[model samples]
Target: MRGKKGNKEVLKRILLCIRPYTSLVVLSLGLAVITVGLTLYVPILTGNAVDYIAGKGSVDFGMLGKLIVLIIAAITVTAAAQWLMNHVNNMITYRIVQDLRVQAFHHLHRVPAAYVDSHPAGDLISRIITDVEQFSDGLLMGFTQLFTGVLTIAGTIVFMLTIHPLITLVVVVLSPLSFGIAGFISKNTFQMFKKQSETRGELTSLTDEMLGNLKVVEAFGYQEKAQERFEEINERLAGYSLRATFFSSLTNPATRIMYSIIYAGVTLAGCFTVIAGGLTVGRLTSFLSYTNQYTKPFNEITGVITEFQNSLASAARVFRFLDEEPETEDSPDAEELTEIQGKVELEDVAFSYRPDQRFMEHLNLSAQPGQRIAIVGPTGCGKTTLINLLMRFYDVTDGNIYVDGHEIRDITRKSLRSNFGMVLQETWLKNTTIRENIAYGKPDAADEEIIRAAKEAHAHNFIMKLPQQYDTVLGEDGGSLSQGQKQLLCIARVMLDLPPMLILDEATSSIDTMTEIRIQNAFGKMMNGRTSFIVAHRLSTIREADVILVMKDGKIIEKGTHKELLKQNGFYAELYQSQFAPS
Candidate 1:
């Protein structure tokens, strides 16, 4: 069985989300009550008409006409009320969906990088899109019928009790049988539905990961392995879905079958009462009408219970995502970085991706304004991790990183990051016009400035060759452009912004050798007076750095200018020779 407290929490949150539309909810439920009330009253009027027409052996055509008119009026009122209720229900459903989607989307931005790194993007997307929609649909459809079903049941039972209390007691006792069956089936189905939802998210994540790395999988001849992984996840999803649906499907038929028996018993008992003159024929007929009305809602409610259970499962998933702790907020007295100098220093820095493993400890470094700092290290030696700390993407665990004499964490993240420009090995370009992609860092940049930035990044010649020049709309992630071209656009973005500090991580790795040379010349001009940190796999790229820091296992093993490092003949010299003197 599901946790009662957790379900209540989910329900409470859902209600809060809908609380803004209180007037709509009241109007919708009111219309449903009115519709059900008119329906129940119709049977009472029909019973009275029957008694009047059967009295004293004379047919009263006038009374019959009047009864017919009243019944028609009730029918019209019921229809109008139902239509209005349905309209309101639909409106509330879509509006709540919109609000929930917006809230989830906004929450994602506030979430920390650690949470994002741990969770798959597709799983997050599933919660926001598919799960929210399922929960919303179930809430709207079930609630629309639920109000009418409940009021109809209560009103019909009360009317039947007034007509014949003895038979109404029978309904009260048998009603539990339907509810019991629904409860039992729902308990079994809840976990199955929950599992199915989880598996669906896994499947979505798998598909996204596979498609995003299709080229790598093909190049490494891992297509069969990828397909096998997909099939495994897909099969698990199918199994859970089948079991959940099978159990929930049992509720309606089982409840209806039990209610059929109750209906038969009520009919037989009423006939005997009428024969013994204990109840009028008209009263028995009215009671029978009310009995059908009362018991039919049990089946409706059983179906609604299944819908609600499924919705609750999906809602639990969505709410769990929204409840994640976001990134730590800036300090109350945080200062904004108004004018940054190029000097940066890391004092007694310590960091680790996990608590048990300290990747870097007691690290200290400093860069003078307008210095070219090149960091060379073996893979997994905390090179990028250092940059992450400086930019405040991840905070230093045990020490301080300062920019212009102020600790990095004391500054607002937006302002601190605004002073640094980054071009990583993996280029990120949006699906938009070429000009827009280049001008992303400065959305309001002038056309001439954008072109000049592109020219400086050595991208203008090829961009001009495109069908629409800068106006060409690129496909998703700029798939229409080559890797080198995409990198150029990314570089142009930073060049246009002209941040005081630059971080280049294999910025020219994807370009051909000739293009690399051209772009490096452009980068040399761009880096003239900026504090730059260059991380490159190709040792030749940083040959002219003001200082080269050779790292091994997160510790600095050597640091000096190129000539000084070479004369020392240390780790940096070995790394440089290994690249230049290849077999």
Candidate 2:
């Protein structure tokens, strides 16, 4: 029952995707029907010509010539309609594919960060590119042929039944066996194809990971292990591909064999009918032609079913991704944070990445306006998670985070986030000019303002040394730049933004001590009037913090000024000592 429902859902989504092109689809189908009708009628006309020649005792040249001309005209019409159908079908199929790709790409942005974090980028990309393209190709073939196949079968059957009911009965009986065989193969193949599609995604993910981190893999001398890992996935993908192909391949031959058997039976029955004078020789010829035409469609349909099964499998994956729940949107009545005071407070904050594991419970903290609150914690102690909650990347499970006394949830995410400038440890830059990278937080920033921010962040020196200076376009996430340079660019962005609040997560961890000192001095000047939360690894950076919260296991074990904590010789003291004590 679940399987049926899933299949129906996949089909429903596919239909919905194609719905916008209904007019073209209808026109394509109409052309197919016209083609099939003309083609079917031509064969009947040819049969009549044969009957005319046979009855006249000799070839009636004039009448035969006229019949031949009529047949030619019908064939010409059929060919024209078939050509038009193919053209229309291709247009409709590719257009639907374009729309689906756009929709899938658009949907990804709306999906929750958790979904993206858990799913591989390569897998999502495969669904959007490979699976969607394959589905479109399959759809094209199915749409192009399915209508003609059905119409030809129905028209051929009707014509055959009219010619000889007994032979048609033989055909009708044997036809079910063909359909039954195709159905059984189709059912088995669907799962295999679906598995193959999934395996392909896995393989793509692994390959993408390996290639994207090839330098790291090579540096670590893990190429052999990576190769083995890729081979394992590749071998499994190949196995699934072979199985899917083998099963789907069974349909055409199996159906064709069944069709041949039916053809033989129909021929025998027709021969008997002709001998009995119930059917003429010309009619037998026509019946044989009709039988092949009828069974030919079944053959085509079996092939279509195989393609359709693959397409359905791919479509299911695409739909599954599309159906992923997006991030919770702000409420309609949510207020915009137009002017923020930089004061933040977390009240009884209880949260966890997973509901089953309660990471933080009854957590409370407060930051006064213009206060530099440094958060010091052991790794995975909900430090970044706290930042995430503060930024509303993930909402609190059972708490309220207030910015200037307004609950973070009550404010629009865009408006709330815009109030804070963040420079994370891991920098991200687009493939664009260094000036644009710095101005990302303020897209309309002036050149002088951008240069001032870069100079303050100590990035202007490197920017001046680059090929095009600030106008240089970076490659793939600014991979062309050094890590410290990237960090400087990010810091420059925050400097340009100069939001009411700041979140720095090891923002200068990549830079040299000299550069870090300069950046810290700049930060000191900037933090004078803005609230700041710094997640520091190097204890030396937060000596002047108004409050230092030492976190462990989601609890703030100690909270005081850095000097106060050191004086007390508690968790913060030990952490600071451990970092700066020795090597």
Q: How many steric overlaps does candidate 2 have?
A: 0
Put down candidate 2 lDDT per residue, 1-583, tens digits, no spaces.
Answer: 1276898988888889889989998898789888988888887788888888888477788988998999999988888888888999999989999999999999998897778889998899999999998899789889888888999999998998888787798899878888888988889888888888898999899888988888899999999998898899889888888988998888878888988898899888888888888987788888899988999989888889898888988998998888889899899999999877888999999987797999987778899999999998889888898898999888889978999999988899989988888999998999888888888878999999999999999999889998899999999878778999999999999898798999999998999999999999999987888999999988899899999988899878889998789899888888878878878
Error of 1 at 326 (Å): 0.7
Task: Write out the backbone clash pairs for model 1.
Answer: none
lDDT of 1 by residue, 313-391 (tens): 8889998988998888899899999777789998989988799999898788899989999998899888888888888
Query: What is the TM-score of each predicted model, taking all chains together?
Result: 0.96, 0.93
- Model 1 residue runs over 4 Å out of place are 52-56, 278-282
Clash-forming residue pairs, model 2: none
Query: In model 1, what is the error at residue 308, expressed in angstroms?
Result: 1.9
